[model samples]
Structures are given as structure tokens and as C-alpha cells.
Target: MIAVLFRWDIKAGSEQLFKEGWSEIVHLNIEKHGALGSRLFKSKDGEWISYSKWISEDHFYNARKSLDNTEQARIKMAQAIIRAYDPIVMIPVIDHLMATETTHINQLS
Candidate 1:
């Protein structure tokens, strides 16, 4: 599996906009582009990070290309970003995906 790590610096007061747009984008990618899934994290230093898994490097690249149509959520995400770092792509050497449990959006707490 291919794992890609992404980081972004968000503009002040745009956090909620970014989160909503990002969640939408991720959902779309998973539904339409054959992405495995992804998780979003906020670092202590304020960098927004996303770790996404894909079937392969080619699949990952292809999926990103599909996002180029300038979808509204994508535009919203871009507007909220101060800067986005180049993605760090990796091939997993050892992976143990032991859990499949997930909470629904409304169940977030």
C-alpha cells in the first residue's frame, strides 16, 4: 500500500472552513477515486497533517488529478490555506491494520 503524508499551514480564522472542506474532499476521494482512507491531525506547532492510504503510487497520483476540476470544497480548502507542503509519499514496509471500527460524523465527540 502507498501512504502519503500531507501538511498545510492554515490561515487564521479559517480553521472550521478548512476542516469542513477537507472532510468533504476526503469523502469524495474515498467514494470516487479508489482511495483507501485518510486521517487528519493537528500538530502542536499548528501544522495540519493528513495521512492517506492508496492502493498504489499510480493510484494516488491519479486520484489527485481527479481533484483538479476545482470542486467547491476544494476551492474552499485552498482559500483556507496559507501554504501547503509537498506530500511525502511512502511504501509501507510493515502494517497491521487491526481495527475497522469508525464512528459516524454525528457521533464525533
Candidate 2:
């Protein structure tokens, strides 16, 4: 699995619009392609971050291609929300032995 993290520092008073636009973009990605899923989060300091999980790097690249006519345009759109944005892709190394049983604990809760 691959995870893509997008960090945005939105301008003051533009949070709502930024979120609305980002939500639309996320919906379009999931609807048009088979993205695993995505989540949006906000920091205590007001920075917005988005994490999207994909089955493979190909899926991520393909979805991004389908979103805009050119790679530059897509990047420009992503950077529009903030003065500076950083995107990172990482592959996690999971250790099943150290993992907890979430299903059982959730049932009890």
C-alpha cells in the first residue's frame, strides 16, 4: 500500500472554501477512480493536511493524470491553497506481531 500526504497552509478566512474545494476534488478522485480512501485533518495551528491511500503507485499516478490535462496544472491546483505546500509519498512497513486486536477491542467499546 502507498500513502500520499498533502500538507497545506491555508490563508486566514479561507478555510471553508479550501475545504469545500478539496472535498470536491477528493470526491471526484474516489468516484472516477478506485482510490482506497482518503481523510482530511486539521492541526491545532490551523494547517490542513490530507492523506490518501492507494493500492499502488500506478493508481496514484493514473488518478492524478486523469484529474488534469497536464501535470503542471494539477500541481498548480494543489498549491493554490497555500503559499507553500509539500507532498510526500511513503510506503509503510507493517509489523503484524506488534499490532493490537482492534476488532475485539472495538466490540467491547
Candidate 3:
């Protein structure tokens, strides 16, 4: 699997708009592009971080290229409220989970 990390510095007063627009983009990537999943996080330093998983780098780029042309407009709208954008693609070397903890979590029903 491949993971992508994006760090965004949002402009003042555009937090809500950024959140809504980002959610929509993530939704489209999942539903239309076969992305595994994605998450958004905010740092104490005020940077918004996004983590997205895919089957492979090829899947990631393929999905991106297949997006509708309108996606550019949506991205531009979102970008208008950003101070900076940084992105990185990574290949995970290690991922660990404790089975007992996982079992405990699964038991929460």
C-alpha cells in the first residue's frame, strides 16, 4: 500500500470551507477512485494534515487523472483559502497493531 501526506496552511476564516471542501474531495477519491481511506488532522501549529491510503502509487495517480475536469475548479476554490500546500507520497515500511487491542476494539458492540 501507498500513503500520501498533505500539509495545508489555511487562510484565516476559511476553516469551515476548507473542511467541507476537503471532505468532498476525500469522498470522491474513495467512491470513484478506489482509494482505501483517508483522514484529516490539524497540528498545534495550525497546519491541516491529510493522510490517504491507496492500493499502490499507480492506483493513486490513475484515480487522480481520471477525476472530472470540474475537480480542478473545486481544488482551485479550496486552494484560494490556503497559504501553503505540501504533499508527499510514501511507502510504509512498518505498520503494527496489537491483536489484543484490536480484539477489544472489535468487541465494542
lDDT tens digits, residues 1-109, model 1? 7899999999999988898898887787787776888888889999999999887888788878885543889888999999999999998898887656565743672
Q: Considering summed lDDT, which 10 consecutive residues are worst modelled in model 1?
A: 100-109
Clashing pairs in 1: none
Tens digits of per-residue lDDT, candidate 2, 1-109, equal 7889988787777665665666666766677666667777788987778888787888788886784434443444455576547678878787253433444642342
Compose the digit string of candidate 3's lDDT tens values, residues 32-79: 777877777789898888888898899888876775544754675466
Number of colliding residue pairs in each model: 0, 0, 0
Q: How close is candidate 2 to the true structure, as a TM-score?
A: 0.69
Off by over 4 Å in 3: 69-80, 97-109
TM-score of each: 0.86, 0.69, 0.76
Query: How much is 85 displaced in model 2, in angstroms?
Result: 2.1
lDDT at 42, model 1: 85
lDDT of 2 at 25: 68
